[model samples]
Target: MRGPVRWVLWDVKDTLLKVRRSVGEQYCSEASRLGLELPPSQVEAAFKQAYRRQSKLYPNYGTAQGLGGHRWWVAVVKDTFSQCGVKDGATLEKLSYNLYHNFKNAENWEVFPDSERTLRSCTDMGLKLGVVSNFDNRLEGILRACGLLSHFSFLVTSEGAKVAKPDAAIFHQALQRCGDPASSVAHVGDHYVNDYLTARSLGLLGLLLDREGSTLHLDDVPARHRLSSLDELPALLQKRAEGG
Candidate 1:
């Protein structure tokens, strides 16, 4: 473990927590209450579409922080409703933001089944842990609420780092906090280019958790491991450590 990976850095959304339901669920429900009459499924679909639109916004806006981070999600909800034939923009936006505020107070975030067990095992193995995420400042509190704050000794967020994935500085900041080497620390994520390849570029181990193959940039990098499931992680890491 002498590489940039003496510590383990995790991504939040899509890595540990699955966000099975929309993060905007409560707000979307409220939108329906305001005569939007939008089906839950339609709202969910619109949310996903709007979420992906942030990729375009970031480059043009030079926004290093995640575009869909709270404020962006507010606009996303507004735009989504507008596109889906909702007439009252101002009221819906307010409702959306109000719902998002409730999320800020929420502690029980849904997580993948293997998430807690995996992090616990990593801690038990004596590895230092941290998070490098394209997240809002609320990430720490959210993880803390989910009973996960104790696992990570540190976290570097886009809000704190002022840059998102593919930026080596963010990862470096995480390593600096953990007092570890990037070469020894394996970065695990579901994203191909943003997380795994970025780790590879920094001489750290890159582990890809490609459940749905949503990693469009997958072919662009030579990842150290391609994991189709989180269940395979512990064994694979043990093998890598033992030179298997």
Candidate 2:
């Protein structure tokens, strides 16, 4: 039997926050500022290709091979423009640098409508909150800027922990900060495998935030383990606490 939840671990991207604009739109806007004009659709497609290639080549920001997050992201950004026909090395480097820092700003990200309210509700229930994200060091500034930083007691990033989600080690790092047994912690994220299955496997209550019902077809996920929005969170936690 699982104990009452004492901590709520959150996943950052697409869970509590998301980019204000699509990758292609942001990249094109930045490129325009650099005096380069590119179609947003074209840039978006190229970005998808570049991102997949980069992720495949340098998983987890290439930490294992010493690339680190900064270098890894710079490569992805540079490749994205390169694939869109920009070949000037200096221009690529400049654009990559600008884009990297641009994302750190709060203007580039927007909090989910229900994020703050739900976080506050969790706090009111006497639950501690922390972040367990696959993001890099830039996450702290992003969270702080978005006004959600104060809600969390700690943050554990894959870059900081050297282990990304679906790997379990990252969750363990968050657990250490939580100072609670796995049975008394719950993790919420948008990814099914990384957030739900993995957390459940580790004995934590895994709640999948499927806002779009994208996972509705997955029979393995019970209704209790899935949420359509953050607005549903506090009630769910209360139900769990009451053994409903």
Candidate 3:
């Protein structure tokens, strides 16, 4: 028989907190501050293109290219600003520095309404919590700003693990940190491939937080492993605790 789950691992981004201002919106704001004028629509379009290109080429947030956290982001920032019509090298560097640093602001993100109560419920149930994310260490700061950092006992990042999700190394690293049997842990996140399938394949219970029913039609996702909101988590796990 499987042991009681002792740990609940989480993913950030669309799971706990979401960005209030998108990258394009922030880029336009920064450009205006630096006296680089461009139409908002143009800036937004450019950012989308740049983001898609960089993401496809480097995937895994540029870690696949052997770029460190900041270096990886620097490429994206450069590509974004360049596409937005700022041609001066000096201006690009300045914009990159300010834009990257400004994103760390707590005001730029909003936590899901059910996040706190759900976390507390897990804590009350005696389940240890930690984060397993593809993000860099800046995640700690963001979580702290959102008041969710304290809820986690530990956090493992792609930068720290030397690999990103869907790859198994990062999850294994988190498992080692929790020091529990894989069957006695659950991982929850928004991504179907990165969060659910990856963890489940490793013998960990994986649930997809499908806030929008985006993947509800996929035949591969079991209904029991899907959630529309975090508020559903404690009760679902309670059933598991009861051997349901």
Question: TM-scores across all candidates?
Answer: 0.79, 0.97, 0.94
- Report how far residue 10 has shifted in candidate 3, in Å: 0.5
Summing lDDT over every window of 10 consecutive residues in candidate 3, give the lowest-scoring window.
60-69
Query: Candidate 2 residues 121-143, lDDT tens each?
Result: 99999999999999988999999
Cα lDDT tens digits, model 3, 1-244, are: 7667899999999999898876677778888898877777777787778778877887766666686677767777788778766689998899888877777878889899999999999999999999999887688888887899999999999887878888998999999999988999999999999999999999999999999999988899989999999999999999989999
List the candidates ranked by TM-score, beginning with the highest. Answer: 2, 3, 1
Top candidate on TM-score is 2
- After TM-score superposition, the amount by which residue 185's alpha carbon in candidate 2 deviates from its true location, in angstroms, is 0.4
In candidate 2, stretches whose alpha carbon ends up further than 4 angstroms from where it belongs are none
lDDT of 1 at 183: 71
**Candidate 1 residue-wise lDDT, 111-139, digit = tens:** 78888999988877767888999886778
The positional error of residue 187 in candidate 3, measured at the CA in angstroms, is: 0.4
How close is each model in CA RMSD to the real structure? 3.8, 1.0, 1.6
Best by lDDT: 2
User: In candidate 1, residue 105 scores what lDDT?
Assistant: 49
